[model samples]
Target: MLRAENVTLSYGAEPVLEGASLSIEAGQFVSLVGPSGSGKSSLLRAIMGLQEISDGRIETPLQSTDIGILFQDDALLPWRTAIENVSLGLRLNGRDRGRAVAEAEAWLERLGLTGLGRRYPRELSGGQRKRVALAQVLALKPRLLLMDEPFASLDAIVRARVTQDVVNLVESEGIGVLLVTHDLEEAIALSDVVYLLSNGPHAHISQRYSVPIPRPRNLVKSRSHPTFAPLYERLWSDLSDVVDGPRRIRTAA
Candidate 1:
């Protein structure tokens, strides 16, 4: 399991997160939801060691827990081809360049970007670029996938498609995911459990909503199910308290 205890982050003297913590177990798909500036991204970066926590600790099963991160934007290299961007981490890890390219190529094919490998970031659609970035990270074979509102910028249809791609690919790899998203429906559709977070300085675990629905989760079915209205209502209500608290906006718009 990946565990974080009393973890916090701050900029100089200003605390961004304080005593914020959560543990994600193996094979679990979890989502973190909160109002903007709630330090959701900060928490993920701290877990990945990309950012330092000021107060507490984050623990992975091992130092090499194979954590992969997908940012909101495509964040691909402009000069590099799509496949090249995917192979970058491998090359930095000392895989032979040719071998890395071949592996990246294979991942591209697996992620629905086979013939598009030669395209640059500028040449790809927003969805296409995001897919390539995902393919890039997956090539590293990380057992833990961390995504920071990855589909937040996509159109509704593209968001759905990308969510499905991520769900299908991660399930196939037996990779656990910790997704940070503003989209309520996305969290419901993709996560096995939704972790609702409070705003920080003293951020606390607000709620843990086990999706309690069947897998291969279809959003359409989720909206119409017996469990749907009640569960969604509860989540929205609880989240509403936090979202509306202290003069903050509740719904994402």
Candidate 2:
């Protein structure tokens, strides 16, 4: 359960978000999609307390407020092995070192990262690293997971697998997730509710598409579904309006 009410974010004189609102009930997976500079990342950081919202309110259950965040970058410690990296969050949360290591290892196994834990970040491939990163967050058992392009770095096949793993985690844990991504297909494939923001210094929700696909949705099958084509076409059209928006000009005398 997370909600941003009449949210606004500005950088000095420039505004990036205006009256953008989103609500996620427990166990819902929501995607925020928009063109570059649409303020998707800003909205997420604000909700996570990493950025200050210029105005409005963000509310979530206190206990669940310690949300987990996964970024496009794995953000793993280069020197640390996978298991060590995974346990970092738990360690910071006052978990005992031994117990944290054990828990992290268990999560790694669940995500299909068993023996890989001994490898350092540099030794792991991109997909392996992302899974290690995901394992790190999932190990926390966060109530809300904020992801900003979690699959951006992986290849298509890897991305699909990672997406499925993430979906599985969300369902099993029943945690709310707000993911910011530019990929319309990825958003639709993985989310229950998709929010599209128009591009601007202060972007607003241009449209919110609710996916009627049944629970336990499949990314591949959903792509070829009849409704998928129309919905995706519209989402792309909305996003392109901003991505290819007219350039501001300087008037000359």
Q: In candidate 2, which residue pairs clash?
A: 15-201, 16-201
- Tens digit of lDDT per residue, candidate 1, span 120-156? 8999999999999998888888889999988889998
Q: Summing lDDT over every window of 10 consecutive residues in candidate 2, give the lowest-scoring window.
A: 244-253
**How far out, in Å, is residue 107 in model 2?**
0.8
Q: Rate the local accuracy (lDDT) of all candidates.
A: 0.84, 0.87
lDDT of 2 by residue, 66-140 (tens): 598998899999989999999888998889999999999999999898899899999989999999999998888
Candidate 2's TM-score reads 0.92
Badly placed stretches (over 4 Å) of model 2 are 242-253
